[model samples]
Target: MSADKPKPAGVKIVDAAKKELMNVSAIERDGNFLVVKGKIFGTMPMTAKLSPEEARKALRMLSPGLVWFLLTFPFRRSPEPPAR
Candidate 1:
């Protein structure tokens, strides 16, 4: 396989990150770069591109915030329960 192609797990890891991270819910890979895209407030478009090392660093930095968001975002109630 060409080195440019990511291993299957790379896609999975990126997918999970996109799902769990705020403002970063879509992602793709371009060679060694990870391409991330999502919306702020679920409406404003945002994007980022990261090399492999940068991607790893970003994930590490985001891990705590992701955990905290997951822990707190769902149970806390809004005036109305969220639609989804």
Candidate 2:
């Protein structure tokens, strides 16, 4: 995609950096770029563009975070045990 083209929201690009890199938590839209948690257990920034559908597809492919997030976000938190 062209540099001028805007990136779709919520897409996670499993590009070379991701493959090379571990322990990443989030992939978010930043301007025209996508910011992913680095494999080094940190954060890595990628400058790429994708369509919304493409973004969603990429997100699903790369990160288990998304799947689990969607799966668990809707449910309420479990209650803690009573104090002794």
Candidate 3:
């Protein structure tokens, strides 16, 4: 990809300095597993497969945070009224 090209929709890996180190190309569910495909330092390809149990654990960890975000979303912003 060209340096000026927009990156595809995916996850980004960053360090403590917030500098991007890698990019995840895709994440998909296959049967009972979750598959993640990405690149290391934008060059080396890597893939990870998560089993159903692992997926469930991930969901459990994320659910509360997700719920809190959703619950507070409406109050986080006030939409401007339409111009008269």
Candidate 4:
């Protein structure tokens, strides 16, 4: 019970998840957990409970630009040398 002690996680991940998810409902918060209830690949109802750290990691992984960058990185040619 100290000011320096961190408070238990709340809904911080909801926003991040929504931004990353973009197409589904992912804004439910339960205690220190984020509950994302929705369909996946139009297959079935996928309900995932994620902690704050997990959510942040997922956000990074789910980034469209990041995914494309990683996919195309190997094929991208390096820049040419500057003119003398």
How do all models score by TM-score?
0.37, 0.25, 0.57, 0.35
Per-residue lDDT of model 1, residues 1-84, tens digit only: 657855343212223334422455567887888788776554566777888887677667767778799789778863654487
Give the winner by TM-score: 3
lDDT of each: 0.63, 0.55, 0.83, 0.64
lDDT of 3 at 60: 79
Number of the predicted model whose lDDT against the real structure is largest? 3
Clashes of 2: 3
Query: Model 4 scores what on Cα lDDT?
Result: 0.64
Q: Show the lowest summed lDDT stretch of 10 residues, model 1.
A: 8-17
Off by over 4 Å in 4: 1-23, 56-84
Off by over 4 Å in 3: 1-7, 62-66, 70-84
Q: State residue 71's C-alpha deviation in candidate 1, in Å.
A: 17
What residue pairs clash in candidate 1, if any at all?
none
Per-residue lDDT over 26-55 for candidate 3, one digit per residue giving the tens place of the 0 to 100 score = 888888878989998888899989998886
TM-score of 1: 0.37
Residue 1's lDDT in candidate 3: 62
Q: Which stretches of candidate 2 lie over 4 Å from their true place?
A: 1-21, 40-53, 58-69, 73-84
